[model samples]
Each structure stands twice: as C-alpha cells, then as structure tokens.
Target: MILAAIWACWTSAALGQAVPNHADPSAREILPNPVPVPAIRFLTSADFPPFNFRDETGALVGFNIDLARRICEEVDVPCTVQAWPWEQAADALADNQGDALIAGLALSPENGERFDFSSIYLALPGRFVTQADAARGFDPSALTGARISVRRGSAHEEFLQRYLAHATLAPMDDEIAALEAVKAGEADAYFGDAMRASFWLNDNLACCSFAGEAYFRPELFGKGLAIAVPAGHDTVRHAIDWALVRLKEGGSLDELYLRWFPVGFY
Candidate 1:
C-alpha cells in the first residue's frame, strides 16, 4: 500500500503538467502508458444508484457517471460505460475485461494488489438505516439479530462485519435491494452512506430512517471514492486523477455534491 501511495504521489507530481491526448501512446503500444485514460471501455455497477445506476431510460446515470464523462472530456477520449451487476463488477474488471472501474468504490487492501486507485473524489462515511423507531433512537446494540442488510462488496459490508458484531448480515445484490429487505420487513436494518442512502430511500424505500451518527472505518472505509485500474497502470491512474482535479477546479463537483447531498438530507 505504501508503495502504491508513493507511486501515486510521484505520478501526480509529474502530471502537474497537462498531458495532451495526442501526445500519449495507447494501452496496446510497445511503450505502454502507465494509465489507460484514453478512448477506453469503463466498467461500473448500475445498481449502486445516485452514484452509478441505470435510469428509467436504461441509460446509466448518477455521480460516477457524471464524473467519468468529465474525465473522458478532460482527456479528450470517448468512453463506453458498461453497467453490470454490482456483485462481481470488480472481479470482472480485474480479469482484464475493461480499462477501468468507477462505481463509488472505497479503497481496500485487497483492491491494491489487483488495481491502481485514483485519489479520493468524495469522503463518504457509513451510516445505518432502520425503522424510524430504531434509527431515530440511535442504538447500535438494537441491531442484534436485526437482519441487517448491506450491499455485497461495498465497504459497508466489511465495516458492519468488524463493527456490528452482534448483528446478522443479510447481503443483497445492491443498495436498493438491501433497503427493500428492510422495507419489506425481511431485514430490520441496513447500512449505507448518508448521501446515497438519502437518494435511495426517497426514490426506492420511502419508510427507512437515516439513523444514528455516521461511522468511519479507517481500516476498511478509507477516505473517499476512487476509480480502479489494473495494478501498475500508473499512466491511466494519473490521467484520471488529473480529471478529478479539473472537476474540483471547475466547480462541477461542488455543484453536484450540493445538489445530491444537500444539508440535512441525511
């Protein structure tokens, strides 16, 4: 992890100078670019909603979608977003199926071995979702045997495991399904991030409450959302990072964050 961090830092320093799309070689060239930022096939999980999800039109939409487009625009590359089931999107990408993955993923130790990660785009702490009666009162112990549902492969899955030792985990394919488990009474509680939980609950599960204070798992949740790439693909990672920097500089991210996570939405 230290090696990756240091590597990322070095790459960032070098990319402080703008890299023109026409100046770089393609991923298949004899002299490989460290990152695969140009004209690439990007992978994502549509079920993550508000971050990356399929709209009613069956077109992919949400924060990651917006962010990825901005990335491609910044690099002058056209991209294809293939929305797959959330459960195995990362594994599918790791097997060399796509150029990148950007589904609001938290940095994990396991991910470091197989993929390079971009700098955090957003800081998202995990929160609990429950009946207004349970969550309004903010009791973690009340979660015991509470058929707790969380999206599989999300950071919350690992967070709840180490932290909610007394609770029973009910894994779901996506956040919408997990929250549905709670709304349907099959699960007493669910775990997710505040910004996303608000959007999901309002649009999918209307009755669940945004409960307790948000929790952090420095060991598991890490700092923010990142784009994942093949390990040692530093050139692609650097280009993506530069794109994120552009969004921050251009105020696009600020507008989106304010719109999506308005104060007290949680």
Candidate 2:
C-alpha cells in the first residue's frame, strides 16, 4: 500500500548544522517594529528538563535559560531569569511579577487574552518512527494502508485522521504504548511527537528510526514555543521577537536547540 517516499534524512550529527541565515517569515512579520526596554525580568519553571531545569550545581539552566540570556544580550538589555512554580508562572506574569515568561509556553487564544507572545522559537513536531530494518522514507500519500500507531484521544491521532486518513491507525492508551506497538512489530510505525520519539530512540528503545519531515499544524500540535509577556507589553514582545530573529540568523538559536535536543528531528 505504500507508494513513493520523500527522503529527508536526519542524524545526531545534523544537530550541529548551521542555522539558516534568514529568519522564518512568521517571526519577521510578527511585530510592527518596536523599541526594546533597558531591563526586564524573565520568569520560568525550571522543572522541565532539556528546556528548563535545575542543574546539579543548583543553577537554573537549560535551553530556555540560555536563549533568554542570549536574547537579552542581543537586545542589549539587562535581564534576569528566575525559576518559579509552574502553576504560578502565569498568575505571576498577570500580577506583574516579571516582564516575560520563557518556559516552554504554548501559544493559545486564552493565553493571548492575558499576555503577548513572541514568535515561535521551538517546536515539538510530530513524526513517524519505524524499526531500523523497515525504515523508509514517507509522505502522507505513501502512508496509505500502513499501520500507524498513535495515542488514543491525542492530537497526534487527530492529525493522522485529518491528514493521512488513508492509513490504518492503531490507537493505544498512551505514547509509550504506541511506541511499544512499533517496537513489538505489532504496528508498522509510531506517529507522535518528535521530542518523545527522539528520546525514546536514543535513550530507551534503541530499536527504531525517525522518518519523514517534522509535521507541525498549529491547530493540532499547537503554535510551537514562544515567550509570554504581560498584556500590552508590545516593546517586550517585540524585543524578544527581534532577538529571536537575530538568534536564528546568527545560528545561536540552532546552537541552543542542539544543546537541548542533541538528536535532530527536522
């Protein structure tokens, strides 16, 4: 049932690849050009690993923290990134506790109502993983009749139904179970978040390979990762957006991405 394929092979070595010279169009057109403030306070929850977490030395560190520091440097502003409780971060932002929140926050309308957001700096793209021997390139059309494993009730499942409706889906209770289905040869492939898939491939199962381009539909996967600022703080938002563009252009963004996600998915 599988037909032609689109090959876009990625490897751990690809993690160090240079960032593109240009910024994404979504970021370039995000704001109407605003000036940056001289100083800002950045808030984050340091409990999330790779993105934000406490180090062995008790220093709050990770991708978000490093990016925040780089953004501050790029904007020529004094900034402070402090760890706060995850649940309290939003309310703290609302209460003027900080100028920005850089913890892997998702973009949504409800969040848009209370805060401004920078253009997406990171994404958790969906991908397919197959056994190394059975690994092959894939496209939506190529997936017809293929047994794809997905977590029941997850956006990944919804995405497959909406886009690759021709494929047969094996809905499991959770991501691990779906992945296990592939590992056990019960399913042709597992469709899920690239982040989780990468971790599982590198640190857990060690029996699969990622296939195809990273899939990101904001409606299904969310608007990637962005920083949140208090409402009406266009300057702060714009500054972050500007810094992000510069970071992308200079490869700093990709550097941080490689640091956190050593395994490149896209």
Candidate 3:
C-alpha cells in the first residue's frame, strides 16, 4: 500500500523541464535483461482517446500504441497492437490472447491480484485553474475561505478536504461543471485532474489558466497507469519495464507525452 501511495505522489518537474523519468536514480545501474520472446501482442481499448484510440483514418493510434511499438523496438521483438472493446480487453489478456495490456489500467489491489504490472509510465496529477487575471499571484496554500470548485465525491474533493480544509468547497456534478464554476466566477478556483484541464485549456477557454504546482496524491487519486500482463508473466512485465526506462532515459517517452498532451498538464 505504501508503494502504491508513494508511486502516486510522483510529480513531474516544472513546466518546460524534461519529463521526470519516475524511475529511482538509486536503482541499480545495470538492469536485468528481459527474457527474449518471439513477439509481443499488445492489447488496448479503442475508447480512451489520446491514450489508445483510433484516428480519423480508422487507424489505431495514440500514445499507448506508439509506446507499445517503441517497446517492441527496444526489446528487439516483433509486436502487434490490437484494439478491443474496453469491457473485454482484460478478459482477452486473461485468456492469453495478448502478451500485454497497455490500456490505462489503474494499479489497484484487485488488479494486482489478477495481473503483473510494469513500472508506471504515466501518473495523473491534480491542478488548479483560475481566471487568467487571478492566476498570476494564486497561492493554494493561502486560501482561507476561498471557494474552490471540485467534482462532488471525486478524489480531488477529498484532497481539498484533507489538506485545504480552510478553503470553502463548491462541489459540482462533474469536471466541466467544476471548471464552469470558476469561469462564471462562482468559485475562486477549480481543482481537479490536470489532464482533463489541459484539453479544456487547449480548447480556447481563455477565461482561465493553470495555477500552482500539480498535486500528486496517489492515495487519493489511485496509482498511475501501467501495462499489465497475466499474473504470472514476469518475463513480459520485466521487458515492458525495462523498455519504459530506456524510453524515458532516451527522451522518447517525453516526446510522446508532449505530442499527445500539447497543453502540458504538469
């Protein structure tokens, strides 16, 4: 549980900086070579756009798709990435139809019992957005009685209640409603998933901009995204993890992140 909680708190460096690798620097200088395999079958869902979704040409394309190919290249193995219905991807993996599942599966206890996981490749962070004018000197720590809009019953709301109890909460029905509250001046700020906020910001919502550093509370938000293999498939899991570290170190992972998330959530 602590590993899960600590992994959740892995935040990226400041904006414009290189993407944080998220691997421990104190980790062994020499990593174990992955057991060789004939080919890797990567299974993903077509629903999660920007991560694993079909493009306009009906071609399977997204960050996960690209990453899977890169992993195969790094490991010197042939690979196939196939998209399935979100509801059935896990079953497909369980039935040995795929070597790995690259969908955005959370590293939960229930999931852990069913599959082996690679190192986290991506983690969602909480962020604050406020009116453009008010964003300049915003201080999340100084908000006493300030109204912050968050989705009702979301982990974000729980974060506010635990660490920013001095601030008044205006819980909304959903992420959009929470953001709308800030744009409409009903709340001083909106605190929620940074990735979602990036899309809204890039959508020409000039009324508000990101403020303050991103918050990474895995305990509240759930452990970040990782590739999953069958429960006993250590070889495939190790290969994925090894390739991920190589990708991060070589800047390929950062490139993919910037390509997909142009607004820079972190």
Q: Which candidate is the best by TM-score?
A: 3
Across 1-266, the per-residue lDDT of candidate 2 in tens digits comes to: 11111112332335453222223445555543424487879999989887899989999988889989998888787889989999999999999999999887667778888988877666567888888766655555787799999999999999888888899999989898898888899999999988777767776446787776667566677657888999898888877887888787676877777777766665
> What ordering of candidates by TM-score runs from best to worst?
3, 2, 1
Per-candidate TM-score against the hidden true structure: 0.57, 0.85, 0.90
The TM-score that candidate 3 achieves is: 0.90
State the local distance difference test value for candidate 1. Answer: 0.68
Q: For candidate 1, report its TM-score.
A: 0.57
What do the candidate models score in CA lDDT, each in turn? 0.68, 0.77, 0.82
- Which residues of candidate 1, in runs, are more than 4 Å off? 1-37, 126-192, 200-217, 220-222, 262-266
Provide C-alpha RMSD values for all models, in order.
9.9, 4.8, 3.0
RMSD of 3: 3.0
Screening candidate 3 with a backbone cut-off below 3 angstroms (N, C-alpha, C), the clashing residue pairs are none
The full ranking of all candidates by lDDT, starting with the best, is 3, 2, 1
Error of 3 at 118 (Å): 0.2
Reference-based lDDT, residue 77, model 2? 78
